[model samples]
Target chain A: MREKILKAIEKNSRIDLKELAIMLGEEEINVVNEIAAMEAEGIICGYHTLIDWEKTSIEKVSALIEVRVTPQRGQGFDTIAERIYKYPEVNSVYLISGGYDLLVSLEGKSLKEVSNFVSDKLSTLDTVLSTATHFILKKYKDHGTVLAKKYVDERLKMTP
Target chain B: MRNPLSNKITTIKPSGIRKFFDIVSEMEDAISLGVGEPDFDTPWHIRDEGIYSLEKGKTFYTSNAGLKELRQEICNYYGRKQGVVYNPMTETLVTVGGSEGIDLALRCMLNPGDEVIIPTPCYVSYEPCTVMADGVPVILPLKNENQFRLTPEELEGAITEKTKILILAFPNNPTGAIMEKSDLEALVPIIEKHDLMVISDEIYSELSYKSKHVSICSLPGMKERTIVINGFSKAYAMTGWRLGYALGPELVIKQMIKLHQFAIMCAPTTSQYAAIEALKNGDDDVVEMTEAYNQRRRFLMNEFKEMNLPCFEPFGAFYVFPCIKEFGMTSEEFALKFLEEEKVAVVPGTAFGDCGEGFLRISYAYSIDDLKVAIGRLKDFVEKLRAEK
Candidate 1:
């Protein structure tokens, strides 16, 4: 039941408990209780909407910054990863497994704003050694929705 | 429509369902629940297989029984999903949609004057196909009390000395009623007693909501006597692919293949290839599509309850047949008035059969947003009708 509820919610976050109950052949109260339990247990951390932000009347810039950090004797990469992820501009941070130790994504108002964050703020951190920032040109897809192109519905008006 | 037709064919009634589509197509702003198909396009991966096949130049006709691998996939699919077993080599033959399978079965099995018991309300093609095959179509009017299931009594009542076939359109269209295992169990005795063969159209089998669909052929000793028709149209959203198949006794299939060899030759080669992929990997797609339909089902069910419209909860297919008898208008009259007043089109129940006269079939295959608007329009129409009385 937990897996099924999560699966439905994963595909569509906006589905209500009543409709979920009908889809799963469970009672409304049961589904409601299960979802509440999941939320309380942190099994469901959050319900995020998948938006085609490009469709809106806003221009945004995003950059991916790779950071090489010196490992503190006791804390290793965890302490540095937490500090980087805590920033408001940092949408995501990961302890990557390649040439770079950490991969951080930053969203900003403009390319200059992103560069300022990297040069002035990110480069000044005590543990960081070097940083490489790459700005995204255009997003073709985001959160499973195609963002760069419009999807036209081609179904016919009538069929037998 | 050409000169090579018989007078019998000329007199056959045109479908009220298609007539409604003509009106819907002419109007720019009308939102129709009249089309009896899923609004979703065939999932991309399935379509990609067809595209891949065509790109590979797979345009030649396959064997009269269809590609062996596709036939095996169909057998394995039914076996895995519904516990149905058929010989892929000898007991299955792919045709064009379930429509062609139904027609082929009727043509191969019916002698002139043979009686076929067809339960109503049903999809529009049943009677016409029976007439084209020179069989007598005996209409078995189903009642609302019975939830449109064919009872043992109804079966016995419809049988005559000439009765040769019983057409079971379970998970029935327009009504959205399905016969559970027990309901099917009840009819086995009467069917066995009458020694009648069965033609079961399960095109919408994958759309059952609350329970898994059970094949009538899966009953004890019935597989030998049932011709099961199923296709990619309703389940996989591959309607235009023109691929369907028949699973039955070896003797029956052999005959069907013989007729098909001279007629269709085989289902479109590319569709058969695509269907192989559909059968092999389409379970997830069906589940996803079913989930969408279930959401709309709950919304419509809840709205109908609130509006006092008296709809029997249908757990199969994508339609809700709500009784409109209280409005004191025939189903056609109600549909026309609704269209003119609200610019929303719903298929009148009578389009399926005359017995469907007091209700309407509203397909829930559209997006929930569209359904909400349509339902809202319906609520207002019904409320105005009540207040005027």
Candidate 2:
């Protein structure tokens, strides 16, 4: 029943409990209660479409910018990163050592927009000292898995 | 006036290889074939030179680039063997190890957000180094049909305006694949057209069987765009000594030397002297070891065939990557269960990359005695598993 409900939800995110119960050969009230419980427990994060932004109407240019900044008198790296991260354009921020203090992953409509943000928004901050930007060529893997490949290929077989 | 907790300690996952190695370290009398390094001791002559250097009180740092003698020897070694000529003073910089050469090269070359093309199922350091360098690592999965070789098509596809450097770790790790001269010739035009830099890690150059290891810098019009990284580790069994060198355009070497000067003034003085001796008198030992490795290579391939595991015949290096998917588990699961059940250790292919998911890399650098023992254990383990099923 669980697999059936999951399958129904997977096929159609707007799946209703009555239709899900019929598909799973279960009672409607039980199915409705199960989904309600799942929702309450936050196991069902709202349904989302994997928008292929590449084909979407919005023009987005993703770039990774490395920023070197000193902390303010009372604040530290986390504070600085958090302040920068509040901007709607900035996607993520990582505090790294070596040459740069912060690595900001961001997206904008154009290169000029990104450059403008760096000059107007990022560098204008009290702590920001310098910035170097490198745009991404491609992302092969993220979040512990391949982003493109369907499955690992296996060609060999052995008999039991 | 500084805070007591000035350094915020960040806890990260321990390296998976070290995690497995630590587990194996606890097992008494385990015949392991897990490590990727060669089993042979550093050649006696090289060891003697290191001892001699220490005895002579040559403990101080050499030139920021490295000892002139060692660099000259490297120049001679490459020119004699691969027809590549590099000025010792300008084109060369000796590093802590090939590992350091890799790090320094990436650090010097990549501006933030630049992309470095790395073929998958490679040494694990490449990805982390790219991230640490603030460069994006674009992994191009090499197909099995290409003999695990990165094709010109793949190279062409992976390139973009942001692509900066291409890491070519030929006589590859994990898979014993070597790119032939013709194979490299095909890539030269593509690389040249893009005007991109190539970091070629040819540390296993001396271990090749069929054809000699070809330096990408040896190609016409490639010297300006290539940094050839080689070391005494795999060649002279000097992994512990930590001696490696890179030769390329003087400008790149200068930038790399600047970084090295600030961070590490010089590589170990003893290692440098020892490396000079290895370059001078190491070819015979390399030949003998390659012969030994070839024999083991044949044995391992035959064993894989008998076990009905498909394995491509590797031309260089000592690893045999065998597809182990038929056992009904991911590579990590299979490796863990195998080690638990049989007490034999091998690196799961997934540790290299996603393409390695169904494979397991077995190094044949151990003695014939250990190889025989490992094969017997493997046979027994497989039989027991089948019986249980």
Candidate 3:
């Protein structure tokens, strides 16, 4: 049941509750309650609307900052991950298993703003030893949606 | 110059749906809910098999009974899916399409003046195929109230001494009706009492929403008398591949293959190869596509209900037949005017048969976004008609 509900939501997040119920062959209230329970249990983390921001003229910058941290006694990478994720500038933080102990991604108003955060806050952490930041050039795709128009439906106007 | 056409062939009616398609083809900015074909491409793995067969230079025709491998796959698929076993070597013969399967089955069985009981509105070919095969086409108008299903009484009432065959298209076209096991069980006694052979077209079998399709052949004592016509088109998105097959008693399949050997030589070698792959590996693809089609079907049914258009809930096929009679327009008039006024195209119900007069067949094979826009346009069109009244 969870798999079906999750798949339906994954395909189209904005699909109506009534439609979700019909697709799963379940009662509407049951689908609603199941979705609510999934939300409460964190099985469904969040819903997102995919946008092709390249179409708009908005200016933005995003960067992934990889950091090598000293693993603390009992509080290893999780505590540092929590600290980095708590920052408003940080979009996501993972305790990565690589030369880098933590991988952080953040978005900013401009390149300068993103670089400033890396220098001023991320690198200034007590346990932080080294940091490497790579700025995103453009998003050809994001969250399973293609950001660019690569193909068009040029099928014959009618078919039997 | 004298005409070269045979009067019998020329007189057979073309699909009324094609006339609407012509107008749609010429018009720009038109959104069609008309065509019954799927929007999905044939899954990549199936296509890859076709390519692999070609690359191997396996392009020569197989025996008229089709490749033994493909026949085995077809037989195994039905044995698992419908619990009906057929001898792959003698009882299964592949054809060009489910269309050809119908043609071969009719042409093989019918003598001139024999009557074929066809429940309509049905797929466009049944009537014409019957006529072309020198059989009289008997149209049994299925009632919307009966959910467009052919009841046992309807079956018994249509049978005459001249009636030799019954054409059963479940997961029906235009109407989207299906006959469950119990529904089909009721017809068996009627069929047996009448001694009628059956041409059960189950091309849209995999698309049933309520449950898996129940083949009449799967019912007791029906297999020997029924030719179950199914193909990869509706189920595997392989319409362009043009591959279908018939499974039945050895006597019938032998003659059908003889006719196919002379007429078609064999079903396309590449398509047969691809169909083998589809049968072996395409179950997940069918399930995924069917689920997607169901979501669109439910959405449209809900939209129709909200707009107060009385639509029977269809559990099979990717179509919704909404009664447009309340708006005081014939199905064709409503469809044409809707296309002209709103640029949204749906088929007039009468295209399927005269009994389809009061309703319209809207295919939900398109994306949900397209269905939403078309439904909104239809709602506006209906509102305007009400205002004019």
Per-residue lDDT value at B305 in model 1: 88
- lDDT score of residue B84 within candidate 3: 90
Cand. 3 Cα-lDDT: 0.90
Query: Number of clashing pairs, model 3?
Result: 0
Superposed on the true chain A, the predicted chain A of model 2 yields a TM-score of 0.59
State the TM-score of the second chain for every model.
0.98, 0.95, 0.99
Q: Candidate 3 residues A1-160, lDDT tens each?
A: 7888898889688888987786666899999999999999999999987766557798878899889998889987778788889999898887777577888999999999999998999889898899999999988878766676554545554554
The residue-by-residue lDDT of candidate 1 on A78-118, one tens digit each, is 99888888889999998889898999998999888999888
Best by DockQ: 1
Deviation of model 2 at B216, angstroms: 1.3
TM-score of chain A of each: 0.88, 0.59, 0.90
Model 3 off-target regions past 4 Å? A18-28, A58-141, A150-160
Tens-place lDDT digits, model 3, residues B1-389 = 99999999889777787788889988878998887788888999999999999999998979888999999999999999999999999999999999999999999999999999999999889899889999999999999999999999998889889999999999999899999989999999989998999999999999999988999999989999999999999999998899999999999999999999999999999999999999999999999999899888888877887888899999999889999998888999999999999999889999989999999988888888778898999999999998899
DockQ of each: 0.45, 0.01, 0.39
Q: Against the true structure, whose TM-score is highest?
A: 1
Local distance difference test, candidate 1 = 0.89
Model 1: per-residue Cα lDDT over B1-389, one tens digit each: 66997798887998877777787788888887776788888899999999999999999989999999999999998898779888999999999999999999999999999999999999889899899899999999999988888899988999999999999987888899999989999999989998999999999899998789999999998999999999999899998898999999998999999999999878899999999999989899998898878877888888898899998988898899999999999999999899989999998899989999999999987887688898999999999999999
Model 2 TM-score is 0.68
Q: Can you tell me the CAPRI class of model 2? A: incorrect
Those runs of model 1 whose alpha carbons end farther than 4 Å from true positions after fitting are A1-33, A47-57, A66-76, A95-101, A123-132, A148-153, B1-4
Candidate topping lDDT: 3
Which of the predicted structures, 2 or 3, would earn the higher TM-score when compared with the native? 3
